[model samples]
Target: MAVMTSQALWDFGRGSGVVALVLLTLSMVLGIATRSGRPAPWLPRFAVAETHRNTSLLATVFLVLHVGLLLFDPYAQLRIFDLVFPFVGNYRPFWQGLGTVALDLMIALVVTSLLRTRIGLRTWRGIHWAAYGLWPIALVHALGTGTDSFSAWFLVLAIVCVAAVLGALGWRLSARFTERRAVAPTMEVRV
Candidate 1:
Protein backbone atom coordinates (compact mmCIF):
# COMPACT_ATOMS: atom_id res chain seq x y z
CA MET A 1 0.00 0.00 0.00
CA ALA A 2 2.84 2.41 0.81
CA VAL A 3 4.61 1.76 -2.50
CA MET A 4 1.51 1.93 -4.67
CA THR A 5 1.54 3.85 -7.98
CA SER A 6 -0.48 6.99 -8.62
CA GLN A 7 -3.09 5.01 -10.50
CA ALA A 8 -3.32 2.57 -7.61
CA LEU A 9 -3.74 5.36 -5.11
CA TRP A 10 -6.39 6.89 -7.31
CA ASP A 11 -8.23 3.61 -7.46
CA PHE A 12 -8.03 3.21 -3.71
CA GLY A 13 -9.47 6.70 -3.29
CA ARG A 14 -12.36 5.91 -5.58
CA GLY A 15 -13.07 2.71 -3.67
CA SER A 16 -13.22 4.65 -0.42
CA GLY A 17 -15.73 6.99 -2.00
CA VAL A 18 -17.92 4.02 -2.89
CA VAL A 19 -17.67 2.69 0.65
CA ALA A 20 -18.71 6.10 1.98
CA LEU A 21 -21.77 6.08 -0.25
CA VAL A 22 -22.87 2.65 0.95
CA LEU A 23 -22.28 3.55 4.57
CA LEU A 24 -24.37 6.68 4.12
CA THR A 25 -27.19 4.57 2.76
CA LEU A 26 -27.06 2.11 5.63
CA SER A 27 -26.88 4.93 8.18
CA MET A 28 -29.95 6.54 6.69
CA VAL A 29 -31.88 3.26 6.80
CA LEU A 30 -30.94 2.55 10.37
CA GLY A 31 -31.76 6.12 11.42
CA ILE A 32 -35.19 5.80 9.88
CA ALA A 33 -35.79 2.43 11.52
CA THR A 34 -34.81 3.79 14.91
CA ARG A 35 -37.13 6.75 14.55
CA SER A 36 -39.97 4.57 13.26
CA GLY A 37 -40.60 3.45 16.80
CA ARG A 38 -38.97 0.35 18.29
CA PRO A 39 -38.13 -2.20 15.67
CA ALA A 40 -40.70 -5.01 15.78
CA PRO A 41 -40.36 -8.78 15.68
CA TRP A 42 -36.62 -9.05 14.89
CA LEU A 43 -35.03 -6.25 16.88
CA PRO A 44 -35.71 -4.66 20.27
CA ARG A 45 -36.06 -0.90 20.30
CA PHE A 46 -32.85 -0.40 22.24
CA ALA A 47 -30.92 -2.60 19.88
CA VAL A 48 -32.26 -0.84 16.80
CA ALA A 49 -31.43 2.54 18.26
CA GLU A 50 -27.92 1.44 19.13
CA THR A 51 -27.52 -0.04 15.69
CA HIS A 52 -28.55 3.26 14.17
CA ARG A 53 -26.02 5.12 16.29
CA ASN A 54 -23.30 2.67 15.34
CA THR A 55 -24.16 3.00 11.67
CA SER A 56 -23.81 6.77 11.87
CA LEU A 57 -20.46 6.34 13.55
CA LEU A 58 -19.26 4.13 10.73
CA ALA A 59 -20.48 6.62 8.18
CA THR A 60 -18.42 9.26 9.93
CA VAL A 61 -15.37 7.06 9.68
CA PHE A 62 -15.92 6.49 5.98
CA LEU A 63 -16.29 10.22 5.55
CA VAL A 64 -12.89 10.82 7.11
CA LEU A 65 -11.20 8.25 4.91
CA HIS A 66 -12.98 9.58 1.85
CA VAL A 67 -11.90 13.16 2.46
CA GLY A 68 -8.38 12.19 3.46
CA LEU A 69 -7.90 10.27 0.25
CA LEU A 70 -9.31 13.11 -1.78
CA LEU A 71 -6.87 15.55 -0.25
CA PHE A 72 -4.01 13.24 -1.10
CA ASP A 73 -5.16 12.58 -4.67
CA PRO A 74 -3.57 15.78 -6.04
CA TYR A 75 -6.68 16.56 -8.05
CA ALA A 76 -8.61 18.06 -5.17
CA GLN A 77 -5.74 20.02 -3.53
CA LEU A 78 -7.81 20.30 -0.39
CA ARG A 79 -6.38 21.37 2.94
CA ILE A 80 -7.01 19.59 6.21
CA PHE A 81 -8.73 22.52 7.90
CA ASP A 82 -11.31 22.44 5.16
CA LEU A 83 -12.86 19.46 6.87
CA VAL A 84 -13.71 21.41 10.02
CA PHE A 85 -14.07 24.99 8.83
CA PRO A 86 -16.34 26.26 6.13
CA PHE A 87 -15.15 28.12 2.99
CA VAL A 88 -11.51 27.37 3.65
CA GLY A 89 -10.82 24.86 0.90
CA ASN A 90 -9.46 26.72 -2.14
CA TYR A 91 -10.69 24.42 -4.85
CA ARG A 92 -14.38 25.17 -4.48
CA PRO A 93 -15.17 27.30 -1.50
CA PHE A 94 -18.95 27.62 -1.84
CA TRP A 95 -19.43 23.95 -2.62
CA GLN A 96 -16.82 22.83 -0.12
CA GLY A 97 -18.62 24.80 2.56
CA LEU A 98 -21.41 22.32 2.14
CA GLY A 99 -19.14 19.56 3.38
CA THR A 100 -17.99 21.65 6.30
CA VAL A 101 -21.58 22.41 7.24
CA ALA A 102 -22.43 18.74 7.10
CA LEU A 103 -19.48 17.89 9.30
CA ASP A 104 -20.48 20.45 11.92
CA LEU A 105 -24.07 19.25 11.90
CA MET A 106 -22.99 15.64 12.22
CA ILE A 107 -20.75 16.49 15.15
CA ALA A 108 -23.57 18.33 16.83
CA LEU A 109 -25.89 15.40 16.26
CA VAL A 110 -23.42 12.92 17.69
CA VAL A 111 -22.56 15.02 20.70
CA THR A 112 -26.18 15.75 21.58
CA SER A 113 -27.16 12.16 20.98
CA LEU A 114 -24.42 10.78 23.18
CA LEU A 115 -25.51 13.04 25.99
CA ARG A 116 -29.23 12.69 25.39
CA THR A 117 -29.97 11.26 28.79
CA ARG A 118 -28.09 14.14 30.42
CA ILE A 119 -29.78 16.89 28.45
CA GLY A 120 -33.30 18.17 28.68
CA LEU A 121 -35.56 16.05 26.51
CA ARG A 122 -36.68 18.99 24.45
CA THR A 123 -33.13 20.20 23.90
CA TRP A 124 -31.99 16.73 22.90
CA ARG A 125 -34.81 16.37 20.44
CA GLY A 126 -34.10 19.73 18.86
CA ILE A 127 -30.39 19.06 18.46
CA HIS A 128 -31.03 15.58 17.09
CA TRP A 129 -33.01 17.15 14.29
CA ALA A 130 -29.68 18.47 12.98
CA ALA A 131 -29.30 15.09 11.34
CA TYR A 132 -31.97 16.11 8.85
CA GLY A 133 -30.04 19.16 7.81
CA LEU A 134 -26.79 17.20 7.76
CA TRP A 135 -28.16 14.72 5.23
CA PRO A 136 -28.86 17.24 2.48
CA ILE A 137 -25.61 19.13 2.98
CA ALA A 138 -23.74 15.86 2.63
CA LEU A 139 -25.63 15.03 -0.55
CA VAL A 140 -24.86 18.44 -1.96
CA HIS A 141 -21.24 18.04 -0.96
CA ALA A 142 -21.01 14.85 -2.96
CA LEU A 143 -22.54 16.51 -5.98
CA GLY A 144 -20.79 19.87 -5.83
CA THR A 145 -17.39 18.54 -4.89
CA GLY A 146 -17.17 15.48 -7.06
CA THR A 147 -15.83 15.53 -10.59
CA ASP A 148 -18.47 12.97 -11.45
CA SER A 149 -21.29 15.39 -10.60
CA PHE A 150 -22.25 15.90 -14.23
CA SER A 151 -22.20 12.27 -15.26
CA ALA A 152 -25.56 10.73 -16.01
CA TRP A 153 -24.88 7.80 -13.70
CA PHE A 154 -23.81 10.01 -10.83
CA LEU A 155 -26.90 12.17 -11.20
CA VAL A 156 -29.22 9.19 -11.10
CA LEU A 157 -27.41 7.64 -8.16
CA ALA A 158 -27.40 10.90 -6.20
CA ILE A 159 -31.10 11.37 -6.87
CA VAL A 160 -31.85 7.84 -5.75
CA CYS A 161 -29.78 8.10 -2.61
CA VAL A 162 -31.17 11.49 -1.63
CA ALA A 163 -34.72 10.41 -2.36
CA ALA A 164 -34.43 7.21 -0.36
CA VAL A 165 -32.96 8.88 2.70
CA LEU A 166 -35.40 11.80 2.62
CA GLY A 167 -38.36 9.52 1.93
CA ALA A 168 -37.48 7.39 4.92
CA LEU A 169 -37.07 10.51 7.05
CA GLY A 170 -40.49 11.67 5.97
CA TRP A 171 -41.91 8.34 7.03
CA ARG A 172 -40.12 8.52 10.36
CA LEU A 173 -41.27 12.09 11.03
CA SER A 174 -44.84 11.13 10.27
CA ALA A 175 -44.68 8.35 12.83
CA ARG A 176 -42.70 10.15 15.51
CA PHE A 177 -44.18 13.63 15.23
CA THR A 178 -47.81 12.92 14.61
CA GLU A 179 -50.21 15.76 15.34
CA ARG A 180 -51.11 14.35 18.72
CA ARG A 181 -47.54 13.45 19.58
CA ALA A 182 -46.04 16.83 18.71
CA VAL A 183 -48.78 19.02 20.14
CA ALA A 184 -50.22 19.07 23.65
CA PRO A 185 -53.73 20.45 24.12
CA THR A 186 -53.60 23.75 25.96
CA MET A 187 -55.82 24.25 28.97
CA GLU A 188 -56.34 27.80 27.85
CA VAL A 189 -55.40 29.69 24.69
CA ARG A 190 -52.57 32.19 24.93
CA VAL A 191 -53.89 35.73 25.41
Candidate 2:
Protein backbone atom coordinates (compact mmCIF):
# COMPACT_ATOMS: atom_id res chain seq x y z
CA MET A 1 0.00 0.00 0.00
CA ALA A 2 1.35 3.40 -0.95
CA VAL A 3 1.01 6.35 1.35
CA MET A 4 -0.11 9.73 -0.01
CA THR A 5 2.75 12.13 -0.40
CA SER A 6 2.70 15.85 0.34
CA GLN A 7 3.31 16.50 -3.34
CA ALA A 8 0.17 14.60 -4.25
CA LEU A 9 -1.89 16.64 -1.81
CA TRP A 10 -0.33 19.85 -3.10
CA ASP A 11 -1.23 18.89 -6.65
CA PHE A 12 -4.75 18.03 -5.58
CA GLY A 13 -5.08 21.34 -3.82
CA ARG A 14 -3.91 23.21 -6.89
CA GLY A 15 -6.24 21.28 -9.14
CA SER A 16 -9.18 22.03 -6.85
CA GLY A 17 -8.19 25.67 -6.78
CA VAL A 18 -8.22 25.79 -10.55
CA VAL A 19 -11.59 24.08 -10.66
CA ALA A 20 -12.97 26.59 -8.18
CA LEU A 21 -11.70 29.43 -10.35
CA VAL A 22 -13.45 28.06 -13.42
CA LEU A 23 -16.66 27.56 -11.46
CA LEU A 24 -16.39 31.08 -10.12
CA THR A 25 -16.01 32.44 -13.62
CA LEU A 26 -18.97 30.46 -14.85
CA SER A 27 -21.05 31.71 -11.94
CA MET A 28 -20.15 35.29 -12.75
CA VAL A 29 -21.03 34.83 -16.40
CA LEU A 30 -24.34 33.25 -15.51
CA GLY A 31 -25.02 36.12 -13.13
CA ILE A 32 -24.30 38.64 -15.86
CA ALA A 33 -26.57 36.73 -18.20
CA THR A 34 -29.33 36.93 -15.60
CA ARG A 35 -28.95 40.67 -15.44
CA SER A 36 -29.33 40.86 -19.21
CA GLY A 37 -32.87 39.49 -18.83
CA ARG A 38 -32.48 37.81 -22.21
CA PRO A 39 -32.31 34.07 -22.18
CA ALA A 40 -30.27 32.01 -24.59
CA PRO A 41 -31.88 29.39 -26.81
CA TRP A 42 -31.12 26.68 -24.30
CA LEU A 43 -31.43 28.43 -20.94
CA PRO A 44 -34.13 30.67 -19.57
CA ARG A 45 -33.39 33.76 -17.41
CA PHE A 46 -34.45 32.04 -14.18
CA ALA A 47 -32.36 29.00 -15.02
CA VAL A 48 -29.37 31.22 -15.56
CA ALA A 49 -29.88 32.70 -12.10
CA GLU A 50 -30.30 29.24 -10.62
CA THR A 51 -27.10 28.06 -12.26
CA HIS A 52 -25.30 31.13 -11.03
CA ARG A 53 -26.32 30.37 -7.46
CA ASN A 54 -25.49 26.69 -7.72
CA THR A 55 -22.14 27.26 -9.42
CA SER A 56 -21.13 29.71 -6.74
CA LEU A 57 -22.04 27.25 -4.01
CA LEU A 58 -20.14 24.52 -5.86
CA ALA A 59 -17.14 26.81 -6.19
CA THR A 60 -17.24 27.45 -2.48
CA VAL A 61 -17.15 23.70 -1.82
CA PHE A 62 -14.12 23.25 -4.02
CA LEU A 63 -12.45 26.25 -2.45
CA VAL A 64 -12.86 24.70 0.97
CA LEU A 65 -11.28 21.48 -0.25
CA HIS A 66 -8.44 23.39 -1.83
CA VAL A 67 -7.66 25.27 1.34
CA GLY A 68 -8.11 22.23 3.57
CA LEU A 69 -5.69 20.16 1.50
CA LEU A 70 -3.13 22.91 1.50
CA LEU A 71 -3.40 23.32 5.24
CA PHE A 72 -2.70 19.66 5.75
CA ASP A 73 0.04 19.39 3.13
CA PRO A 74 3.45 19.36 4.77
CA TYR A 75 5.07 20.97 1.79
CA ALA A 76 2.78 23.98 1.91
CA GLN A 77 3.36 24.76 5.61
CA LEU A 78 0.39 27.11 5.48
CA ARG A 79 -0.89 28.28 8.81
CA ILE A 80 -4.50 29.28 9.41
CA PHE A 81 -3.50 32.92 9.69
CA ASP A 82 -1.83 32.64 6.30
CA LEU A 83 -5.17 31.81 4.79
CA VAL A 84 -6.72 35.11 5.95
CA PHE A 85 -4.04 37.54 7.10
CA PRO A 86 -2.12 37.68 3.84
CA PHE A 87 1.66 38.24 3.35
CA VAL A 88 2.61 36.51 6.59
CA GLY A 89 3.27 33.05 5.27
CA ASN A 90 6.73 31.50 5.14
CA TYR A 91 6.32 30.66 1.46
CA ARG A 92 5.52 32.97 -1.42
CA PRO A 93 4.14 35.64 0.87
CA PHE A 94 3.10 38.15 -1.77
CA TRP A 95 1.42 35.65 -4.06
CA GLN A 96 -0.14 33.90 -1.09
CA GLY A 97 -1.41 37.20 0.16
CA LEU A 98 -3.31 37.68 -3.06
CA GLY A 99 -5.03 34.34 -2.55
CA THR A 100 -5.92 35.34 1.00
CA VAL A 101 -7.42 38.60 -0.19
CA ALA A 102 -9.43 36.81 -2.85
CA LEU A 103 -10.70 34.34 -0.29
CA ASP A 104 -11.67 37.14 2.04
CA LEU A 105 -13.69 38.75 -0.70
CA MET A 106 -15.44 35.47 -1.45
CA ILE A 107 -16.28 34.98 2.22
CA ALA A 108 -17.93 38.38 2.37
CA LEU A 109 -19.91 37.69 -0.80
CA VAL A 110 -21.16 34.38 0.51
CA VAL A 111 -22.04 35.63 3.93
CA THR A 112 -23.94 38.59 2.61
CA SER A 113 -25.77 36.46 0.08
CA LEU A 114 -26.93 34.02 2.73
CA LEU A 115 -28.24 36.88 4.82
CA ARG A 116 -29.46 39.11 2.02
CA THR A 117 -33.07 39.18 3.22
CA ARG A 118 -32.08 40.40 6.62
CA ILE A 119 -29.52 42.80 5.20
CA GLY A 120 -31.89 44.54 2.78
CA LEU A 121 -31.60 44.48 -1.01
CA ARG A 122 -29.71 47.73 -1.35
CA THR A 123 -27.12 46.73 1.22
CA TRP A 124 -26.81 43.26 -0.20
CA ARG A 125 -26.45 44.60 -3.71
CA GLY A 126 -23.75 47.00 -2.60
CA ILE A 127 -21.78 44.15 -1.07
CA HIS A 128 -22.54 41.74 -3.88
CA TRP A 129 -20.84 44.02 -6.38
CA ALA A 130 -17.62 43.12 -4.60
CA ALA A 131 -17.74 39.87 -6.55
CA TYR A 132 -16.50 41.76 -9.59
CA GLY A 133 -13.35 42.53 -7.65
CA LEU A 134 -13.01 38.93 -6.53
CA TRP A 135 -12.56 37.60 -10.09
CA PRO A 136 -9.48 39.63 -11.00
CA ILE A 137 -7.94 39.14 -7.58
CA ALA A 138 -8.40 35.40 -7.89
CA LEU A 139 -6.94 35.51 -11.42
CA VAL A 140 -3.83 37.30 -10.27
CA HIS A 141 -3.50 34.97 -7.29
CA ALA A 142 -3.62 31.95 -9.61
CA LEU A 143 -1.08 33.45 -11.97
CA GLY A 144 1.32 34.51 -9.29
CA THR A 145 0.98 31.48 -7.03
CA GLY A 146 0.12 28.65 -9.37
CA THR A 147 2.78 26.22 -10.56
CA ASP A 148 1.16 25.96 -13.99
CA SER A 149 0.29 29.60 -14.44
CA PHE A 150 2.38 30.01 -17.60
CA SER A 151 1.64 26.61 -19.08
CA ALA A 152 -0.26 26.60 -22.35
CA TRP A 153 -3.27 24.80 -20.91
CA PHE A 154 -3.54 27.15 -17.98
CA LEU A 155 -3.15 30.15 -20.26
CA VAL A 156 -5.94 28.85 -22.43
CA LEU A 157 -8.13 28.35 -19.38
CA ALA A 158 -7.44 31.87 -18.17
CA ILE A 159 -8.19 33.32 -21.59
CA VAL A 160 -11.46 31.46 -21.78
CA CYS A 161 -12.44 32.64 -18.31
CA VAL A 162 -11.71 36.27 -19.13
CA ALA A 163 -13.45 36.01 -22.48
CA ALA A 164 -16.53 34.45 -20.95
CA VAL A 165 -16.97 37.29 -18.51
CA LEU A 166 -16.24 39.93 -21.15
CA GLY A 167 -18.69 38.39 -23.55
CA ALA A 168 -21.38 38.24 -20.90
CA LEU A 169 -20.74 41.84 -19.93
CA GLY A 170 -20.97 42.95 -23.54
CA TRP A 171 -24.19 41.06 -24.00
CA ARG A 172 -25.65 42.69 -20.89
CA LEU A 173 -24.69 46.19 -22.08
CA SER A 174 -26.24 45.56 -25.46
CA ALA A 175 -29.41 44.27 -23.89
CA ARG A 176 -29.67 47.35 -21.69
CA PHE A 177 -29.16 49.57 -24.73
CA THR A 178 -31.87 47.75 -26.63
CA GLU A 179 -34.25 48.15 -23.69
CA ARG A 180 -33.58 51.88 -23.59
CA ARG A 181 -34.15 52.17 -27.32
CA ALA A 182 -37.43 50.28 -27.07
CA VAL A 183 -38.67 52.71 -24.44
CA ALA A 184 -37.37 55.81 -26.27
CA PRO A 185 -40.17 56.05 -28.87
CA THR A 186 -42.75 55.82 -26.13
CA MET A 187 -41.25 58.93 -24.57
CA GLU A 188 -41.27 60.95 -27.82
CA VAL A 189 -43.24 64.22 -28.04
CA ARG A 190 -47.02 63.57 -28.28
CA VAL A 191 -49.52 65.99 -29.87
Candidate 3:
Protein backbone atom coordinates (compact mmCIF):
# COMPACT_ATOMS: atom_id res chain seq x y z
CA MET A 1 0.00 0.00 0.00
CA ALA A 2 1.29 3.46 -0.84
CA VAL A 3 1.78 5.84 2.06
CA MET A 4 -0.59 8.76 2.06
CA THR A 5 0.83 12.26 2.03
CA SER A 6 -0.42 15.23 4.01
CA GLN A 7 -1.85 16.86 0.89
CA ALA A 8 -3.61 13.65 -0.13
CA LEU A 9 -5.20 13.36 3.29
CA TRP A 10 -6.29 16.96 3.17
CA ASP A 11 -7.71 16.59 -0.29
CA PHE A 12 -9.53 13.37 0.56
CA GLY A 13 -10.85 14.89 3.76
CA ARG A 14 -12.10 17.95 1.96
CA GLY A 15 -13.68 15.90 -0.77
CA SER A 16 -15.42 13.63 1.74
CA GLY A 17 -16.67 16.63 3.66
CA VAL A 18 -18.18 18.13 0.52
CA VAL A 19 -19.82 14.82 -0.44
CA ALA A 20 -21.21 14.49 3.07
CA LEU A 21 -22.72 17.93 2.91
CA VAL A 22 -24.38 17.25 -0.40
CA LEU A 23 -25.74 13.93 0.85
CA LEU A 24 -26.99 15.52 4.04
CA THR A 25 -28.71 18.24 2.05
CA LEU A 26 -30.35 15.62 -0.14
CA SER A 27 -31.40 13.69 2.96
CA MET A 28 -32.89 16.81 4.49
CA VAL A 29 -34.93 17.57 1.42
CA LEU A 30 -36.10 13.97 1.06
CA GLY A 31 -36.99 13.90 4.76
CA ILE A 32 -39.16 16.95 4.35
CA ALA A 33 -40.74 15.37 1.31
CA THR A 34 -41.39 12.18 3.26
CA ARG A 35 -43.01 14.10 6.10
CA SER A 36 -45.27 15.85 3.66
CA GLY A 37 -46.90 12.48 2.84
CA ARG A 38 -46.96 13.26 -0.84
CA PRO A 39 -45.69 10.90 -3.48
CA ALA A 40 -43.05 12.17 -5.85
CA PRO A 41 -43.76 12.39 -9.57
CA TRP A 42 -42.14 9.01 -10.01
CA LEU A 43 -41.48 7.47 -6.61
CA PRO A 44 -44.11 6.28 -4.17
CA ARG A 45 -44.25 7.74 -0.68
CA PHE A 46 -42.48 4.72 0.83
CA ALA A 47 -39.69 4.97 -1.75
CA VAL A 48 -39.14 8.60 -0.84
CA ALA A 49 -38.88 7.68 2.84
CA GLU A 50 -36.54 4.83 2.01
CA THR A 51 -34.41 7.14 -0.10
CA HIS A 52 -34.28 9.61 2.77
CA ARG A 53 -33.10 6.92 5.16
CA ASN A 54 -30.47 5.62 2.79
CA THR A 55 -29.24 9.12 1.96
CA SER A 56 -28.89 9.97 5.64
CA LEU A 57 -26.94 6.79 6.30
CA LEU A 58 -24.70 7.47 3.31
CA ALA A 59 -24.14 11.00 4.52
CA THR A 60 -23.09 9.66 7.91
CA VAL A 61 -20.58 7.34 6.27
CA PHE A 62 -19.02 10.24 4.32
CA LEU A 63 -19.05 12.35 7.48
CA VAL A 64 -17.06 9.69 9.32
CA LEU A 65 -14.58 9.63 6.46
CA HIS A 66 -14.30 13.41 6.56
CA VAL A 67 -13.56 13.45 10.28
CA GLY A 68 -11.26 10.43 10.17
CA LEU A 69 -9.21 11.77 7.28
CA LEU A 70 -8.90 15.19 8.88
CA LEU A 71 -7.85 13.59 12.15
CA PHE A 72 -4.86 11.99 10.46
CA ASP A 73 -4.08 14.95 8.24
CA PRO A 74 -1.19 16.82 9.86
CA TYR A 75 -2.43 20.13 8.54
CA ALA A 76 -5.79 19.84 10.24
CA GLN A 77 -4.20 19.01 13.62
CA LEU A 78 -7.48 17.59 14.88
CA ARG A 79 -7.41 15.83 18.20
CA ILE A 80 -9.87 13.10 19.23
CA PHE A 81 -11.04 15.46 21.92
CA ASP A 82 -11.83 18.05 19.27
CA LEU A 83 -14.15 15.56 17.65
CA VAL A 84 -16.35 15.46 20.75
CA PHE A 85 -15.78 18.82 22.41
CA PRO A 86 -16.82 22.04 20.74
CA PHE A 87 -14.74 25.19 20.13
CA VAL A 88 -11.40 23.75 21.21
CA GLY A 89 -9.54 23.06 18.01
CA ASN A 90 -6.22 24.55 16.87
CA TYR A 91 -7.74 25.55 13.54
CA ARG A 92 -10.83 27.70 13.31
CA PRO A 93 -12.07 26.62 16.70
CA PHE A 94 -15.51 28.17 16.49
CA TRP A 95 -16.34 26.66 13.11
CA GLN A 96 -14.86 23.31 14.02
CA GLY A 97 -16.79 23.51 17.26
CA LEU A 98 -20.01 23.79 15.34
CA GLY A 99 -18.91 20.68 13.47
CA THR A 100 -18.41 18.89 16.78
CA VAL A 101 -21.89 19.87 17.86
CA ALA A 102 -23.28 18.68 14.57
CA LEU A 103 -21.41 15.39 14.94
CA ASP A 104 -22.89 14.92 18.39
CA LEU A 105 -26.36 15.54 17.04
CA MET A 106 -25.72 13.09 14.21
CA ILE A 107 -24.64 10.48 16.75
CA ALA A 108 -27.88 10.94 18.65
CA LEU A 109 -29.89 10.73 15.46
CA VAL A 110 -28.16 7.56 14.28
CA VAL A 111 -28.48 5.79 17.62
CA THR A 112 -32.09 6.75 18.02
CA SER A 113 -32.82 5.72 14.47
CA LEU A 114 -31.19 2.35 14.95
CA LEU A 115 -33.23 1.81 18.10
CA ARG A 116 -36.38 3.30 16.69
CA THR A 117 -38.28 0.05 16.74
CA ARG A 118 -37.43 -0.65 20.38
CA ILE A 119 -37.76 2.98 21.48
CA GLY A 120 -41.18 3.52 19.98
CA LEU A 121 -42.18 6.12 17.41
CA ARG A 122 -42.82 9.02 19.78
CA THR A 123 -39.47 8.83 21.53
CA TRP A 124 -37.58 8.26 18.31
CA ARG A 125 -39.35 11.15 16.66
CA GLY A 126 -38.49 13.48 19.53
CA ILE A 127 -34.79 12.73 19.17
CA HIS A 128 -35.06 12.87 15.41
CA TRP A 129 -36.07 16.49 15.63
CA ALA A 130 -32.39 17.14 16.28
CA ALA A 131 -31.99 16.58 12.53
CA TYR A 132 -33.56 19.96 11.95
CA GLY A 133 -30.72 21.49 13.92
CA LEU A 134 -28.08 19.25 12.35
CA TRP A 135 -28.30 20.45 8.73
CA PRO A 136 -27.77 24.17 9.30
CA ILE A 137 -25.01 23.57 11.84
CA ALA A 138 -23.24 21.32 9.38
CA LEU A 139 -23.78 23.84 6.61
CA VAL A 140 -22.25 26.66 8.62
CA HIS A 141 -19.33 24.46 9.59
CA ALA A 142 -18.63 23.72 5.93
CA LEU A 143 -18.87 27.35 4.86
CA GLY A 144 -16.72 28.62 7.71
CA THR A 145 -13.95 26.03 7.63
CA GLY A 146 -14.04 24.62 4.12
CA THR A 147 -10.84 25.21 2.16
CA ASP A 148 -12.78 26.01 -0.99
CA SER A 149 -15.47 28.02 0.72
CA PHE A 150 -14.53 31.19 -1.12
CA SER A 151 -14.48 29.59 -4.55
CA ALA A 152 -17.29 30.43 -6.97
CA TRP A 153 -18.17 26.77 -7.45
CA PHE A 154 -18.42 26.10 -3.75
CA LEU A 155 -20.53 29.21 -3.21
CA VAL A 156 -22.91 28.16 -5.93
CA LEU A 157 -23.14 24.67 -4.45
CA ALA A 158 -23.88 26.15 -1.07
CA ILE A 159 -26.55 28.40 -2.52
CA VAL A 160 -28.17 25.45 -4.31
CA CYS A 161 -28.23 23.37 -1.14
CA VAL A 162 -29.76 26.24 0.78
CA ALA A 163 -32.38 26.72 -1.90
CA ALA A 164 -33.28 23.01 -2.03
CA VAL A 165 -33.72 22.85 1.75
CA LEU A 166 -35.77 26.04 1.92
CA GLY A 167 -37.96 24.89 -0.93
CA ALA A 168 -38.65 21.54 0.72
CA LEU A 169 -39.38 23.24 4.05
CA GLY A 170 -41.77 25.66 2.40
CA TRP A 171 -43.60 22.82 0.68
CA ARG A 172 -43.83 20.81 3.89
CA LEU A 173 -45.22 23.73 5.89
CA SER A 174 -47.75 24.63 3.23
CA ALA A 175 -48.90 21.03 2.92
CA ARG A 176 -49.29 20.72 6.65
CA PHE A 177 -51.25 23.95 6.85
CA THR A 178 -53.52 22.86 4.03
CA GLU A 179 -54.03 19.48 5.64
CA ARG A 180 -54.93 21.06 8.97
CA ARG A 181 -57.27 23.57 7.38
CA ALA A 182 -59.02 20.84 5.43
CA VAL A 183 -59.73 18.89 8.63
CA ALA A 184 -60.73 21.86 10.74
CA PRO A 185 -64.34 21.95 11.92
CA THR A 186 -66.54 24.79 10.86
CA MET A 187 -67.78 26.97 13.68
CA GLU A 188 -71.33 28.39 13.70
CA VAL A 189 -71.53 31.80 15.44
CA ARG A 190 -74.93 33.33 16.11
CA VAL A 191 -74.87 37.05 16.94
TM-score to native of every candidate shown:
0.75, 0.88, 0.90
Residue-wise C-alpha lDDT for candidate 1, range 127-150, written one tens digit per residue: 877776777777788788777778
- Model 2: weakest 10-residue lDDT segment is 175-184
Error of 1 at 35 (Å): 2.0
lDDT scores of the candidates, listed in order: 0.74, 0.87, 0.92
Best by lDDT: 3
Error of 1 at 133 (Å): 0.6
* Model 3, C-alpha of 150: deviation from truth (Å): 0.8
lDDT of 2: 0.87
Once model 3 is optimally superposed onto the true structure by TM-score, how far is the C-alpha of residue 101 displaced, in angstroms? 0.6
Stronger candidate by lDDT (2 vs 3): 3
The number of clashing residue pairs in each candidate reads: 0, 0, 0
Inter-residue clash pairs, candidate 1: none
In what order do the candidates fall by TM-score, top score first? 3, 2, 1
Of candidates 3 and 2, the better by TM-score: 3
List model 3 lDDT by residue over 128-176, tens digit each: 9999999999999999999999999999999999999999888777744
Count backbone clashes in candidate 3: 0
